[model samples]
Target: MKNTIAERIFDFLKDFPPFDVLTAEQLIIIARNVKVIYLPKDKFVFKIEEEIHDHFYVVKDGAIGIFRKEDQVLVDECDEGDIFGLRAMIRKGNYILSAKAIEESIVYSISSLLLEEIIQTNTEANKFLIASFATNTRNPYANDNKGTLFANVKSLQKNESSLTEVQSAQYSKNPITCQLKTSIQQAALIMSTKHVGSIVITENQKPIGIITDKDLRLHIATGRFSIDDPVESIMSSPVITYPENISVAEAQIAMLQHKITHLCITKDGTANSVLTGILSEHDIVAIRGNNPSALIKEVKRAKTAETLQHIRKKVQQLLQGYVEQHIPISYISKVISAINEAITQRAILLSLEEMNTPPPVKFSWLALGSQGRKEQLLITDQDNALVFENPPKEQFDVTKAYFLSLSEKVTQKLNTIGFEFCPADMMASNPRWCLSLDEWKNQFHSWITKPDKDKILLSMIFFDYEMIYGDKNLVDEMSESIFGSIGSYKIFLNFMGLNALKNPPPLSFFRQFLVEHSGEHKDQFDIKARAIMPLVDAARLLILSNNLKGFNSTIARYKKLAEVEPQNKDLYESCINAFRVLLRFRTQQGLKNNTSGRFIDLKSLSKADRLKLKGCFKPIKDIQELIKVRFSLSHML
Candidate 1:
């Protein structure tokens, strides 16, 4: 029962990941199930499309070269502690890559079933083993996969378990309120002072009407009505009411169906009942993070900017966990975007409170640049703008002033929360960027029509905007306006394609990493400029030229491109894989150095990591060539 050889395998695996993160008791369960085999140098472990072993392999000694069966060129070299054969376990697809021993090897073949049990919650292991071909390096213990990494991830497990959507959710006990007799000034004073988004207008402890931030902004702040008017005058009558014991799922569906944020909670489930509490999107967002639903819950309850800042840090940990667990890039983007947008929404509400007044006009907060693309992985400089519904000409200055004041507070709080201010002052607080819907539309048209280098550069960044919070209709119309402009002036796509080609393929003729030449980043590899941006630019331009909409993510764009242009599927697929690795590499560097992961120190990378980096460049080169051919840019070049 002792099995000395198996014990030795356990000892080695325990020192590495999913295993390292596991307990001795847990490792014992796994170590007992492993199958050890000897592989002499140049001998094959498994041939391509060979029947996959029920177990995955880990190297105990020597290195294994994983080769594409087609060309037989080694794609990755796995040394001690590296994993292989995981994809086969997951996909049961015939081995796409063959593994061979480059030197005499002692391999521990781990029972896939055993790993599934022992590290069931070990997302770190799941992330580590997500893609077998991804293992060019030694260990995958760097990030918390939060137990979502493996085949047993059970995508809906959290929903089935943690979210008892039928069970009554905890509602706010102390509901903020205003009486019908209350003046608009009194109501605004109450809302601003208490920092609530809405006030239930009640009579005889029964919900009668409601006034929200939106109501205040549209009806009074824009000079539509005087502050002296009774709150009832502008209140949305017959307040949407729910019972105090309503389920989280019910609350969400109701909010969506009614197109409302605040729902009045009553002693009974109907509008005729006595007001007991209020549920809002704020309440739903605060449902708790045992699941994704719970994660947003913490984001919702962040009372102070500092609290939201703290949540932002937690979001980073979650992000790192997702990356570590090898979650799909698309899913990761959606999760992070939810967290990010929630934070921005919370901050915006808080900012409104700080201003002692509601927004002067209906407005939306738009996240620009990378955030717009929803591809933001690491915290970077804030690129944002404010777009408001245009006010009457006489009230424009006062309206702009109110929004500018709110933006200043929000941006400062966001800065405190760790999103650094945009060095170029392209934030909502900047008058140049903050504009009426008409103004933003005109600015976008100018950028498209002019086609000058400065304007083109602006267009590249400004065009991919996504609304973080506020009015969705405003953003939709603005997007419509932008596409209309692009439709008429189609030459802009050519200009954009030209601009996207600014950063050439990331390798020299020698296949070396093309690093920066001088300035603050001398001798450093500018991964963002040379590697990441090229793909980002390519994806954006491709989508734009095709007149596609709603795909802001680079990975999504690439995935779509592969779908529409099936001829380029392999190329797009390769680009996606490469992009994932490069992005992960950048994040690792950024987390390690406490700086942006843009400038990588090539000397710091191991030979294996360097090889992996090189592997990712091929797709970049191929994509650029495609772009050049598609745009007919040989003459321009």
Candidate 2:
């Protein structure tokens, strides 16, 4: 009997792993007994605890879900070229997982009897089986316990999955090691051969100390010691050792704690245990790619503004990937905020290097408006302030002039990086914003105590100011001043609360969006100012009343408010959830249209999106009710 279809199956199988290692003739022989099968969506190929079949299945098309027995949790989805059900078959055990077709699918099953026969004689195939089996033991696809794996597999092939948060970090398992008795020359020679900067010194395979190139240069090359010195003479003893399972963050912390660049990983997480590997700060950093800290380091290391510009572009690319991967919008915002703050700091650092004289005293750099709130998603206007420590009477004018010039350069660079200077000139470059810490306190004191309509409007915007870069003491001093002033002026929060309720959610009497009465956006609703800012401003006002100083973000303020006041928990939780949805919607709209996303077309949204938007209004209404009662704004109205 000629197995024509089995021969075709063998041809496809020979091109992929494990099977690829099998000889052409060996593969064709196994293929003769292969089972060609098809499954419809939701049809089970095998159930949990079922006895193992003689054959293992390989997906030919569509997808098959391998679900955990409990709660029917999907562990992995096997699509084309993916193999499953083999481990149970080869081990002669009952199936621990259930496999069902996620979509109508076709598969080919290869007999384990034939697999064992071919693998025994074929060394390459045997080795491939061992490696594949080892990987399966680790449960590489465990995180996708309930997720559709097919959605991620296509991107995996393109290497785009590496940018995703779900991707696992790759770490070194086999570390460079040497005996403590080895001469510095021998260790240095080994390092040079291996192209490594650091080597671990061990005793009976237990990590004892570490020696890096820096030590050799500082101790040996400077004529202080000879090249024949034992590696222990210059070795940094009592080396830091972390578990072999250390996360990227743990590795970073270990590096900082020891003030050393390398960490030894051991079997049981102690210096007495056998060394399994070394995790260099460089290694951790390489795998920590796309994080906020890494991006900042890249910006600092950048020799040219053009290089910084390129890193900024990568930041945007990372942001897009985060959004597409469905990372929580709040988390995405924090990471981007950190990157933005780092960029500003790097710009400041570079500008200081360019300046002839250093800043005279401690100062605070404030990001005013949306950026101050850490809510600036797109590159919007540059709204910032610089508050310096009060200068002596003699140096006042000279110090002020010098800092102002520095602010101008920093602002210009920020403008180049896409943050447009505020049209109203609300920047540190403006003399009004750049002031002494005492002056800023006095400025806020006047606004809070007096509180005219204009002053109230200014206070509402300025009160959320976040310190982007500067001396911590200066920012802390400013916050203390604001809180102190507010203590004497309890009415300020009432006024601020009244101001927040002014916009009224932008919904008309018929539950339809109310477009602007007149302006460039006359026919379009102002989502930012009307729907978003009012809620953000209200959250800040409410939280500040409870003596919260640093709560800048709207959602975070509401969350904190919920924690302190349990009676308002539901309302605050609703606001946080609503804000997340709105933010997600705005970012999606902005990405699609390449605009500010402040004005969303009501007609453009789907029925489900519109329904979700409507759902958000319930919290908006409830919060406004609380504000009206607490502020006595009903009398004001």
Candidate 3:
């Protein structure tokens, strides 16, 4: 007899991992025993501490969020072709985390018997499963045990490795140590001679206290303690200690939890045992090459635009590694943005030094568009503006001229450092963008009161303004001016809503990508204009209408929206996830082809890649509908 349902399940499973490696006979056998289950939004598939089910689940459609029981924080979100509830089944233990439907979802549950008999015996499939366990469990050590079958599973193709998180942290074996009775002066001498930031105080080879550069600055330099005083007077007692076998993640967590920068590696992972080595924050940063803190420090020390340019290249390499390693896009974006901001800040300082004299008045430099939102991953065109304190009517020209000259120098330095000048001349160097505080308020008022196509476009970019240098109060005042104008006019948000819907979801009736019909990107997909911008625009409009402030990035805005409007939390969360996927997809594509990643050739995508791209469009369409109804954009459109 024909088992059509089983055949359908087999078809879907064959496209995903583990099952993808399974033979036709083996997959069909597992699929035959699969049972389909449907869940509405917020419904629980299994609760924490529940007995392990006979089966584990694979998502067929929609999303499932795995939540930690204590905090209810969503740890991992499983989507199409994603497997869940399997870790408990594999361990034969009760569920440690709860699985809930994030939206209307269909999941296929396969018996543990089939998993043990068919999939577990296969080497490739077993490796993939172990990798999945490592990722979903958030356990850095799961794949680190060399004696376990899971060891080296990170080498599997397309598997997300914990990378530095799981690797055994390298510590300085020859730690600089001082006796508990050593004077502060002698300890300081030892630290300087060894070129180390800290020194541990030990008794019988066991760490009892630690002193760092911070201690010297606070205790001796501040005249709080004499340099001749014993180290015990200033040393922080009960030194934080870790095992020699500690992983980077464990060391980092211990540091954060204890509020310390150095960890004493001991023989038995306790301060009671012999101190074997020392691990500092700098060591961890060194392990993760292109670390944000190290990059920022380099940026500060950089003397020329050329030096900054070199650092920016390192930033690109870091981004590539993060993309390939499957790091969370949110974390990657923050790190990259911080480095970019530091570079920009350094550029401004260099430009200021070249000026004939100090600025005549206080001013703020604003980063517009993607940089403003802290979402820039690639070195793209610079969008910036400058706002100085309102000048005296008699001295307006002189004040404006001084800032314009300064702006010109800053923009040139930035361009030299690889941020190409904005093609449209929407830069601080342009007189139109270099304005007084009052002038900027009036400019914003004009755009908000009389909404038009060009103004809407400018608003989309300029409204996400973030101050890179100068008075944050000025930016805060500017924000107030913008909201005040919107509150008065009330129709600007509706206009913004209409603009957000201009680029419909990048899918057609047949569920195929809608590629560009003409132009330089003819027959290619515009991921940015079609997919990314819609989500960005929607978040901006919704957040602006709510009169909220300080939420800049699309992800941050959506997260805030989810918190404020819990009724629509699912929709907002979906938007957040979809935006992340689209952003990561664009960045990966950009890194691959060395272009802006806006246009993608459909032919180059694999079946799995295409499906992943398609998954993002649903949230885009749903959010557009919500905007249309909420802002009454239906009639306006």
Instruction: Sort every candidate by TM-score, greatest first.
Output: 3, 2, 1
Indicate which candidate wins on lDDT: 3
Off by over 4 Å in 2: 1-165, 174-293
Relative to the true structure, candidate 1 has a C-alpha RMSD (angstroms) of 14.4
Worst 10 contiguous positions by lDDT, candidate 1: 145-154
Deviating ranges (above 4 Å) for candidate 1: 1-82, 86-292
Where model 3 places Cα greater than 4 Å from the true spot, the runs are 1-3, 39-56, 66-75, 84-104, 111-123, 126-162, 165-212, 215-220, 223-279
RMSD of each candidate relative to the true structure: 14.4, 12.6, 6.1
Whose TM-score is greatest here?
Answer: 3
Residue lDDT tens for model 3, 1-637? 1659988898888877668777888998988888999999899999988998998888888888887643265656677777788778867889988899988999999887887787556887777666656553332333221111222333554433346655688999999999978999999999999999999999999999999999999999999999999999999998888778777655655564475789999996788999999999899887875555567779999999999999999888767766654446787787788789989999999999999899898999999999999899988999999999998899999999999999999999899989999999999999999999999999999999988999989988999889999988888899999999999999889899999999999988888799988998899999999999999999999999888999999999999999999999989988998898888888988888998888999898766678888889989999999999998878877
Candidate 2: residue 171 lDDT (0-100) = 54
For candidate 2, report its TM-score. 0.64
Tens digits of per-residue lDDT for model 2 on 45-145? 89878999888888776668787643255655565666788777756789878899876789888888788888889876665555445433212222221
> How would you order the candidates by lDDT, starting with the best?
3, 1, 2
